[model samples]
Target: MNDGWISDEEERTPQVTPVYSQTFGRGGGRGRGGYGENRRARGFNSRGNSWRDEGNSGGNTQRDGGNIGGNTWRDGGNSGGNIWRNEGNSGGNTWRDEGNSGGNTWRDGGNSGGNSWRNGDENITTLAVKKNNVGRIIGKGGSKIRDLESESGARIQIGKPSDEDYGMTVEVTLTGSEDCRQTAKRLIEELTDDSAPRSYGGNSNSGNSYNVEEPQEEKPRYIDFAEANRAYEEAQKERWAQLPPLKKNFYIEDPAVAAMLPEEVANFRKVNNNITASYALGQSPENSPIPNPVQTFEQCFSEYPEILTQIYNQSFTKPSPIQSQAWPILLKGLDLIGVAQTGTGKTLAFLLPGLIHTDLQPIPRSQRGGPNVLVLAPTRELALQIEKEVKKYNYRDIKSVCIYGGGSRRDQVNIVKQGVEIIIATPGRLNDLVQAGVIKVASVTYLILDEADRMLDMGFEPQIRKSLLDIRPDRQTVMTSATWPEGVRRLAQSYMKNPIQVYVGSLDLAAVHSVTQRIEMIHEDDKIARLFEFLHDMQPDDKVIVFVGKKARADDISSELSLNGVSCQSIHGDREQCDREQALKDLETGDVRILVATDVASRGLDIMDVTHIFNVDFPRNIEEYVHRVGRTGRAGKTGEAISLFTREDWSQAHELIVILEEANQEVPHELYDMSQRFSAWKEKKNEDRGQGRGGGRGRGGGRGGGRPRW
Candidate 1:
């Protein structure tokens, strides 16, 4: 043991004064003797007899014979056996017994203690134990001490810490006969030793082991939230400052295209900071000149003949109404808000000018560092559709990629790493990629917020705002929406400068004029049978879209149609992106004759030659109804729309009538009757409540006196 492991009591040297006795007997002889301090006594016997001796402090005793034993007593614990016994007080004591067939015992009741051992004979010694480990020697409520005593046939006593050691070390004394002292000492050493393999919270093993406990872990400290947020904002500002500056107000380089315009067109664009028109319904800065609408494709793309050629190649003879006004405003490097119905050529209006802006930049495309144009869409399908449109008119070798959720992120990241000029993306995935450093938004100069109203309605405004934080504020922004709601107007005010407004049709909720609207008043249970009856009239080459309110309903209708030998497929938010794409492909390739879908497909998908639209479930609101009807009658093509309206949809009857009458479609008398009945029932319920509350003077009481407003 190390010196630090020893205590003052354990270093004492006993003052030995030897006393010897001899006894001879054939049977047995017994004798007991007590000695004073620091004395040694030994007795020799011939036959079956035992000698017991008790000694004072710092004393020793020994007995030798056949069945020999020794006993010593100090100020310590007690033990009784066949051969020897010991009692001691304040000092260390040693006793040894050598014989053939007997045992020995030693006890120490001193301020110090004794340790016992056996090597061919029994001896008593002293042991010093660290104060912290004394508990392991004794265990819970003395249970482990009793168990050790029973197993080793020894008495174990745990004493208080020694005074000379300043209570840093405890003394554990053992007393026994024969080899039991050795067994008990070894077990105690294993329990108190730090290197011993410990079994926590269980019984000690019989072989050689002990139960030891582990220490508890420390708790975490508190954090300073305000300081953390300040550091984060400073880092963001540093990153933004490192990006290159933005260049603005550049135009197309073709002098020939510039010459086609009147001299007034060139001077007006140079002088004014905003664009406006008398035909559009929006406000701008005072005295902002409205550029004249283009009359022909030659006028729209006169600066870029190649784009003009591509436009004519697609067989578009003239510009659409929104196009005629939007082209001149965007090409002049002014921000614009185009309010037009779906399928009115809004994609090409922003896309063409964006291509021109990108190609005409002072910095070359290769040196732009990242994509120059970012288009934020609300849905993956719309982003992909915009990508398809972008692929058709390839001007100046500009490439585009669509990024959205529910698609392979690895593939998208790899494509972004390869340089591209235009990035069409949904807001959620675009924000994710920007945060991940897969996309850098600092280089974007031309930004498009398509379907602005729909994006807000779908709860994507937070994502949209986050995506625009790193983009340059002076870039030309274009916002297109089917409806000019307050949300879209607010977004335009925050993002776009004093922008030109070009609206093709009326701002009120209206469907396409090219589609003939039809409505059938029927019971709820009769819708499926009526659907089959409508499908019977479908032409062999004609494609149709069935709009339902719920995804489950779409599946139900598609399954019913397939069972009756009609080919159909379904698409909704729940379907995988691959499956949704396959369904659209199947419908477009003439592999499926009908597509049943929710309003998710209603907003901006431009599927060609859709001959009919069936509203198996009425849309939740009339705004969706307009977009759903606009799907079939696109690009001046004539189509038909049929709807099944039941009594459950009475709340929307008035709005539905307004849309039908605005489109000049025929309305059935039964629908008018149902509308009247709903109004009457509502009025009656209000009157009943009024009588209960105001003594029959209510607004429903035919101008009766309730109260007067100033």
Candidate 2:
């Protein structure tokens, strides 16, 4: 017997006699190697007999062979065995009499627990553990293995490496009851991870060398999407909170202004302010009172005779409403925000003052560090146009240049180095030059941000902020926008210093009254056919600007129109800068009477005699629609704006009606029906969704059980 294996029966032989009495017969004797034989021979039936037979019968009994029931084990003179025995009855009582009944039982000598063969509950299992993990299972001084044995009631054995394994792995053996062996194996796998080792053996017969590689350590990184989104929202909120609030509007009364003016100036104010348009002043401080509007060329440039002479040379007639109020505020060296329609003279409103501010600086042009005036435009076309306006008034020969993306970088850099007083640039190229050290902002005393709202929408706020970071805070700043949106208000609050606002009309978004707005509800397939029909009725010398929603659509329409014997040109962001410029030039020079374009030409474009604005596709929003219609009715000219609306644009019907009503234009009944139908469909969809989510219950708890605004 193994010294480590202890038997419960041997340890308490005297105490377990009573318990063994019921299992064994009352007079059964216990003897060395005779316990199983005595129980099977004395108390149990003999081999090859029936289960009920105790003593063998010499003569044939009632249940004997060939009798009715005698010797049931070999009844009917059968050579084949019955149910419990095999054929010939030689394998007597296979289940009870031969194997388990007398051999291999707990009452036998195998009950000692040191038996070499396993009984029913005993089990053996093997695991292959990697060399590196062997120490993990054994622990310090084999303490872990000892604890595992005591806890699981299992015997654990470590074996030497086998020749085939090449010492890369060690074998672990576990011996115990089934449950105990399983518990110990699970514990070892948990401690050592029990992964199969990697082996690169060439050959075992030739005793070739083996290569083994340790598993690489794994370190994983994670990103929290929810936390990242929360942080981004927080950053945006903090950025918005840094700016001050916008000041309220202060009305400009005609009587108060006319009381202090001459008759000529009073008539000008009466004819223009509050009648032809509205005027309002805002955020102006009491220390510097606001200046009166300049109505004429003489009144505007009376202090500078050279400027007046240049104005006459350029055929000056009168001041536009925006220019009339904007010039006075900008000329006083105060920050100004000019809000008006797109066709209003907003460019010259700030440009002339910028030129005057640059030329009149205390430092001479040569001594000033770089350009003294900087104009930031949203598009290259607008920048070039502003530069052209600056050239028209050559006061004191003030040099200027326009630099933008897709232009010759070397040429622009050379122009900057040659010492210009005025610099017109788009935000992108201006930032690039600033980073490249080719332009300086420290000496820029006059700054103008044209089309401020468009610049914000195009995601140019970062470049604008970076460009302004180095400029002196006290510099004169002027900003212009067609609509005063919240983003534009926040930007103005951050950059301007109590700027005075001079808006020509109502601040609410409205189309120009000069443009006769018309809407026609049509099918999507009929727009092309209808377009040519509209173009056929065009009067001679009447120009048109066709606005589409996308670049590809603009090219398609232009090509179709040209093939149908109509002259046209297409312009969009994807076109080259020179090509866009040429397209505009062709339209203005009547080389092409129709200009097919996207929203890129909606704002800051000045083309004379553009008698009509046609919308091939209604704009994405009402704000863009307003800007597109304003393209034709510019410079006090009357024009017509026609839009083709389809069912796909039903989502914008409500907002389009509001704009049309504000402009006093007719709203078609079909548009109202479309809006009503879309609303009904949206409400029905939400109802069905709510019913499904609530499982027939009325209105689930959160968010009314359905999403808002499909």
TM-scores for all candidates: the values are 0.61, 0.62
Q: Per-residue lDDT of 415-482 in model 2, one digit per residue for the tens?
A: 99998989999999999999888898877778888999999989999999987777765677888999
Mark the regions of model 2 whose C-alpha exceeds 4 Å error after superposition: 1-284, 682-710
| lDDT tens digits by residue: candidate 1, 583-637 | 9889888899899999889988988889999999988888988899988989989
Cα lDDT, all candidates: 0.73, 0.71
Best by TM-score: 2
lDDT of residue 661 for candidate 1: 93
Could you tell me the lDDT of residue 189 within candidate 2? 82
lDDT of 1: 0.73
Error of 2 at 335 (Å): 0.6
Say what the RMSD of model 1 is: 16.5
